[model samples]
Target chain A: MKLGRLNHVGVATPSIERSVAIYRDRLGAEVVREPFDLPAQGVRVCFVDTPNSQIELIEPLGADSPILKFLERNPEGGQHHLCFEVSDIAQARDFFESGAVRILGPTRIGAHGTPIFFLHPKDMGGVLTEIMESPKQAH
Target chain B: MKLGRLNHVGVATPSIERSVAIYRDRLGAEVVREPFDLPAQGVRVCFVDTPNSQIELIEPLGADSPILKFLERNPEGGQHHLCFEVSDIAQARDFFESGAVRILGPTRIGAHGTPIFFLHPKDMGGVLTEIMESPKQAH
Candidate 1:
């Protein structure tokens, strides 16, 4: 149940293009990948690569997207969640459940194509947290 | 203006002790440093070290703390800001200014005893961002 590196900081945005522009033009981020759609996850995702970690910019793909509610609360969008890596997803789930930390749902494949689960904000000090299985690229 | 590593993610909390326990016990974080008070910055800070980056848990130290309003808005505390390392603080400040981005204040020595400046959330897509001079230990 040990936590690994922080994979990325999830940011919800109304427009991925606008967010990308700021990260690149304003912040001088050099490696911003093209935005792509993840229909299964209902998000259009773009990854801004920093030297050690990434900033994940996500926009709702459809009306039923999970992050739509978050955008509603923060109209201009903002930091949405923090994703931390764990070596084993099942073991992490067990640890969280045993500790009475509420899991949002069953573990499912996340945007990065790894098994992932979310912890409720109420159980995570009011910050939505995502536990992701360590990605191969990270190693 | 090369962007350095993601220095740390700043988390605002009502209680640093409570936040430390959750990171240590629930998340199995191995290195939860002792909480310390920064009277000048008006924050009680504790750092939760992840393998690649750190989580800065900050609690309001005084009534006049800058984060008090954020706490009032998000009573349970939440993800406060994302801090990234820069090779030169003054150069970074000029770059941000040249792009028409709003700098929160004059670059000043931060809690880490390094020059740092904050960006206006409104200018950065509703997310507060901190630019910190790369720390020596990171190298």
Candidate 2:
């Protein structure tokens, strides 16, 4: 359960293009990946690279999108979750379970193509948290 | 406004001590600052250090705390804002103003003892954002 870097902050956005504009045009961000769909995850995602971390702009893609409920609660969208890297996802999951922390679901391949699992907000200081294993290859 | 490092993600909490324990005992974070009150800001704060950025845990210190409304809505507390460093505070403020990105208030000294200002969530993709000058002396 050793904590590593703050990988990225997941931001739920109603429009990825508009969010990209804010990061690129308004914030003067130099690198922003084009929005791409992850059908399995039910979202379109764009990465806005900062000097040390990234802003993950996520827009719902389909009717059964996981973030649909969040968007319903916050029509304009907002910060969704915080993702942190761990050396090993298995150990992290085990630690959380042992400590009675609720894991939202099974570990799955995340947008980064690394194993990741979500922790319930109720167990994470009311903030949804994602624990991910550091990717072997640079992404 | 040129984006620098993702300085920190502010987390509003009901109890800084409980939040500190979650980061330390549960998340296995190695370094966490002792909670301290910032009377000027009307919140007690603590920092949970990650490798690249820190998590600022904030708790209301008095009746007139600015985050009182947010806490009322989310009684369990949650992520509050995202802070990014900028090289020049004056230029950053000007850029936001010229772009019609509402700045919440006059630039004031932040927890890091550097000039900082909050951006309206309406203009920031529904996420409250803090623009801060890179501190001359690291905190």
Please give the distance, in angstroms, between residue A21's alpha carbon in candidate 1 and its true position after superposition: 0.5
**lDDT tens digits by residue: candidate 2, A1-139:** 6779999999999999889988888788999987789998899999999989999999999999999999999888899999999999998888888886899879999888899999899988999999989999865
Q: What would the C-alpha RMSD of candidate 1 be, to one decimal place? A: 1.3
lDDT of 1 by residue, B21-130 (tens): 78888888999887788887789899999999999999998889998998999988999999989988888888888777888878887778899999999989889999
TM-score of chain B of each: 0.94, 0.96
lDDT of 2 at B114: 90
How would you encode candidate 1's per-residue C-alpha lDDT over A29-117 as one tens digit per residue? 99998788989779999999998889999999988899899889998889999999999899999888888799998899987889999
Q: Report clash pairs, candidate 1.
A: none
Our model 2 lands, by Cα RMSD against the true structure, at 1.2
Interface RMSD after interface superposition, each candidate: 0.9, 0.9
Model 1 global lDDT (CA atoms, 0 to 1): 0.89
Best by TM-score: 2
lDDT of 2 at B66: 92
Interface RMSD of 1: 0.9
